[model samples]
Target: MNNLFHSLLVFATFLGLLWKIHRAFRRASPIGDGCVCGGELCLSSP
Candidate 1:
């Protein structure tokens, strides 16, 4: 039981971290811009 609980906790934490990173990336990148690379790597939208 303890092991299962621990696994769930770790999984939840990982998911939370991933969600935060996803949000950060979204904020860094503009919407409707299918580009992940920011700055010079990304092309300017017309």
Candidate 2:
């Protein structure tokens, strides 16, 4: 029982970390804009 509880706690922590990383990446990279690899700039629609 204790082992199961420990495993669940660890898994929950891992998932929380993953979510934070995903959010950070999304915030860093805007939609419809390719990564900063010298690619053509995506013009915003008026």
Candidate 3:
């Protein structure tokens, strides 16, 4: 029982980390400068 709970906890934590990383990547655009306001394009870098 204890081992199962421990395994589940580890798995949940791993999933949470993966989710955070996914969100971060989605927030930052790969092409050009990363736009913060979800605008169509960034004309210049700050």
Ten residues in sequence with the least summed lDDT for candidate 1: 37-46
Off by over 4 Å in 3: 30-46
lDDT of each: 0.67, 0.62, 0.64
Name the lDDT of candidate 2.
0.62
Question: In lDDT terms, how accurate is model 1?
Answer: 0.67
Q: What is the TM-score of each candidate against the true structure?
A: 0.65, 0.64, 0.62
**Winner by TM-score between candidate 3 and candidate 1:** 1
TM accuracy, model 1: 0.65
lDDT of 1 by residue, 1-46 (tens): 9999999999999989976785577676666434554454234542
Q: What ranges in model 2 sit over 4 Å off? A: 32-46
Descending-TM-score candidate ranking: 1, 2, 3
Each model's Cα RMSD = 7.6, 8.6, 8.7
| TM-score of candidate 2 on Cα atoms, chains taken together | 0.64
CA error at residue 42 for candidate 2, angstroms:
22
Model 3 scores worst on lDDT over the 10 consecutive residues at 37-46
